[model samples]
Target: MILKTYRWSFVVTAVGLVLAALYGLSAHLGIFQAIALVLILSVLEISLSFDNAVVNATILERMSDFWRKIFLSVGIIIAVFGMRLIFPIVLVSVTAGLGPIEVVQLALKGGNPEDPGTYGYELNQAHPTIAAFGGMFLLMLFLNFIFGEKEHHWLGPVERALEKVGKLEYVQVIVAGAVLLVVAETFATDHGRTVLASGLAGVVTYLLVNGLGELFNVEEHLDHGEHPEGAEAEASGSEGRKGPTGAAKATGKAAFFLFLYLEVLDASFSFDGVIGAFAITSDPVIIAIGLGVGAMYIRSMTVHLVEEGTLAQYPYLENGALWAIGALATILLLSIEIHIPEVVTGLIGLAFIVASLISSIRYNRAHPEAAHVETEATAQAG
Candidate 1:
C-alpha cells in the first residue's frame, strides 16, 4: 500500500534531498547541517499542515481520477515552486520596488542588521497585507463550512445553532466582512487601508472561485435530473444512463476550477509556513526545498486518505479540519495585534483533529449500522 500510494512522494523527496545537499555544498555548509535543516523544515511544514491534508482529502474524494492525479502531480509543482519560492520573491519585488534578481540575492544574503533593505525586512513589511488576504480567505472557508447544513454534528448544539443562523442568506459573507472590518479598523492601524483592501480582495477571490466551481458542476446536476429536457434525454439514452457523458465532457471545466480552488487554498495555508520559515533560516532556497518536501508529503497524504476511505470511515474528520481552519483564521487575524507562535497554531489544529477522531470513533461505536452504510457507499464510489 505504501509503495502503491506514496511512490511519487518518495521519489520527489529523494530528489529534494539531493538538491538540498547540493545547495548546502555550494554554500560551504556541512552535509549533516544541510540535511538536518531540510529535515527540520519538512517536520515543521507537516506539523503545521496535517489539518490541511484532511481538508484536502475531503475535496479530493469528490474529484475524478484524472483530476486527482493532476492534483498530486501538477499541484505539487505549484505548491513548491509557486508558493515556496516565487510567491515571496514576487511579493518582495512588488512591495520593495526591487527587481526579481535583487530580491533573490537579498533572500540568499540573509538580513542585514544595519541596512533595512533586506528580503526578510521587506517581507515583514508586507506581512499585514499577506495576513489580511490569507486570513480573510480562511475565515470565509471556516464560516461556510460551519454555517452550512450538515447531517452529522460533532459539536451538536454549536453546529446546529450555526446551521440555523446559516439559513440567513449570505450570512457567512456578511459575518466575514464584518470581522474583516473590525480587524482592520481596530488592530491594523499603520496599514489599515492595505489590510482592508487585501482582505476584500481575498473575499472576492473566494466567491469567484467557489461560484465558478458550482457553475461548472455539471455532474451533480445531471445526476439529480436537474438538467434541461434536451440535455436530460441525451444523458438518459447514454448506455442506460450509467453516467452522464455531459458531465464527463464538462469535467475539464469543473476540474480546472477545482484545481484553482485547491491552489488558492494551499497558498492561504502557506502564508504562515512561509513567514515562520524566516524565523529558522533566511535562505529562500533552503526554505523552498524544505517546505517543498513537506508539501509533497501533504499531497501524498491527501491521496492516501482518499484511497483509503479515511474520511468516510471517520465522518467528522472534515469537520475537525474546518474547526482547525477556523481557529487558524482567527489566529491569523489576531496576529496583526500580537505575535502568535507557529507551535501554538500547530498544537491548536492537532487538538481539534484529535478531538474529532475521538468523536468519530465514539459515533461509529454508537451507530454501527450508519457506519456500515457509509463504508459500503464509499466502496461503491471508489
Candidate 2:
C-alpha cells in the first residue's frame, strides 16, 4: 500500500536512473558511478527543496485538476530547461559569446575548454551579472514577505493607490511601462533605481501570473469570500444561476497563475543549486541528468502534496516555505559577491522543511479530525 501510495515517484525515479545509466554507458562512465551520480543528485535536490515543495503544495492543492497537470509537466520544463539549460548558456553568451556547447565543454575541461583538470570548480568565475540578479532577487523576496497581501491585511496607502490605478486597466500597463523605462534609464548608475525596478518587476510578475490564472479558469479551493464554502446554494439562489463546485473551480484561470507563480519561485530557488552542481561536475550531460532527475521528483512530490491537502491540514508549513524562500533569496543575493557553501544553504532550508513536516505530522495526530475523509473513505471501502 505504501508502495502504491508513492508509485508514481518510484516509477519516475526508476525511469531517470535508466536514462542516466544509458547516458553514462554511451559516455564510457562506469555504470555504478553514473547511477550513483543520478541517485545522489536526486536525493540532494529533494532534500534541499522540501520546503519549496510544501509551499507549492499548499497553492497547488487549491488549483483545479487541469492546472495541477500543467504544474507538473510545464513546471518541470521551465525548471529544467529554463534555469538549468537556458540561463547558464545565456550567461556564457552574454559574457564571452562562447557557444553554449563550447561553454559546456569549457566547464567540463576544468575552467578551460583546452585543459580538463586545470581549474576544478572553485576557480571558474561566475558572470558578474549574476551578482545583480541575486541581490535583486533577495531584496524583492524580503520586501514581498514584509509587504505581501496575505501577511499584511491592508495594502496601505501605496498599494491602495496602485489598486485604484489598477482598476483602470490600461493605467496599470502604462504605470508598469513607465516604471520599466525609468528603471532602465537609472539602473546603470543608481542603487535606488535598481531597487525600484526590481520591486516593480516582482510585483508586476505576480499580478501578471495571477491575472493569467484568472483568465485560464484555474480555480483554487480557497474559502475566499468571493466564493465562500457552504454559501454556494445561497449564492446560486440569489444570483439565479448555477455555481461551480469548489473542486471544479479549483483548476480554472486561477490555477494557471498559481502554476506560473510556483514555477517562477522554483526557478528562483534553483539558482544556487544550478551553480553549485557545476562545482560537483562540469559535465553538462551529467549536470543535466543529475539535476533534472531530482527536479522531476520534487515536481512529482509537490503534486502529491497538493493531492493530499497537506498545506490545508497544516498551515504552519506555509511559514516553512516562506522561510525557505527567504533563505534561498538571501543565499542567491550573497552568492553574487561571495561563494557560500551550497551544503550550508541546502541544510538550513532542508531543516526547515523537515521540521515543518514533523510539526504537520504532530498536528495531524493531535487533531485527527483533519483526517476525517481518509478515515471515512477507508471504512467505506473496507
Candidate 3:
C-alpha cells in the first residue's frame, strides 16, 4: 500500500537517476560520484521542503481531485522548469537589462560564471526583491492562521494571545502592514522602493487569491457563519432549488483559486530557497534533475497525507507548519540585509514540525480516542 501511494515518486527517481548517469558519462564524471550527487541533492531538497509538503497537504485536501491531478502534473512542470530553471533567468534578464535568451546563452557556455554578464552572478543579485514578496506572503499566511484559528491552540499562551487579538477586525492586515513597513525601513535602505513594491504586491496578491478561494469555499463560509442561522434554512432551500450544479460550480471555482494559491506558495518557497541549491553545484542540469526528483516526491507525499488522513490524525501538524512559515518569513525579511544559511532555515522549520508531531503523539497516547478537549499544556502535565 505504501509503495502504491508513492509509485509515481519512485518512477521519477528512476528516471532522474538514469539522466544523472547519462550526464555523468558524457561529462566523464564517475558513475558513483554522479549517483551520489543526485542522491545527496534529492535528500537536501526533500529535507528543506518537508514542511512545505505538510502545509500543502492541508490546503490540497480541500481541493477537488481534478485540481489535485493538475497540481501533480502541470504544477510539477512549473516547479521544475519554470521556477527552478527559467524564473531566475528572467530575473537576471531584467536585472542586467539583457534579453532572457542572452541570459540562457551565458549560462550554457564556458565563461567566467562570476562575471556580471553571466547568469550565475546576476541571478544571485535578484534574490532580495523575490525574498520581499515571498516573505510577506508567508508572514501573512502565518499571521492569518494563528489569529483566526481560536479553537486549536498548539503553543499554550502564544496561540491564545493571538486568537484574542484577532477578535478585532482586519487585525492580521494591520499587523502585516506594520511588519512590511518595518522590513522596508530597517532592512531595505539600499533598495527600499523595489522591496516595498514587491512586498506590497505579495500582500495584495495573497488577499485576492486567498479571499477568492475562501469566498467560494462553502465549508469556510459555513464555519465562519457567512450565512446566519436564521437565513441558513432559506439559503439551503434556495440551494436545493438550484441543485448540486450550483454548489459544484462554486466548488470548481474554489479549487481553481486554491490551485493558484498552491502555485504561488511553491514559487514563494522556491524563490528564496532554490537559489541556495546552486551552492552544491554550478551545473544547472544536475540541479534541475535532482531537485525535480525531490519535488515530485514532495507532491506525492502531500497526496498520500490527504488520502490517508494524516492531518486528521496529527492535527497539530498544521499548526507547526504555520509556525515554521512564520519563522521562515522573519528569516527571509532579515536575510535581505544579512546572510542566513539555508540549513539554518530548514532546521528551524523541521524542528517545529517534529516537535508538533511528538506533541500530537503524546496527546493521542494519553487520550486513546482523542477528543478536542485536550490542550498542549494539559497533555504535558499529564
Give the root-mean-square deviation of each candidate in angstroms: 3.7, 7.4, 5.9
Best model number under lDDT: 1
Candidate with the larger TM-score of 1 and 3 = 1
User: Lowest summed lDDT over 10 consecutive residues: which window, candidate 2?
Assistant: 238-247
How far residue 41's Cα lies from its native spot in candidate 1, in Å, is 0.5
lDDT tens readout by residue for model 3, 1-382: 6797688889989988998999888877767777877887788788888889999988886666677789899999988898777787778788778887787886664233356655666776777788889999998898899888543578979899879898999998999999888878877888787789899999999999998887776654464444423246245443321211122212466778898899888888776556777677666667777888888888998888766666666768888988999998898888888878889988999999999999878877877656343333223312
lDDT of each: 0.84, 0.58, 0.77
lDDT of 1 at 235: 58
Q: lDDT per residue, candidate 2, 64-164, as tens digits?
A: 55676776677777777777666766666545656667656655553432343332232234422453444344334434443343422122475445445
> Deviation in angstroms for 345 in model 2?
0.8
Clashing pairs in model 1, backbone N/Cα/C closer than 3 A: none
The residue-by-residue lDDT of candidate 1 on 57-154, one tens digit each, is: 87776567788889988899999999999999999998889999998888888773234887888987878888899999989999999899875788
Candidate 3 runs further than 4 Å off: 27-32, 110-115, 218-250, 371-382
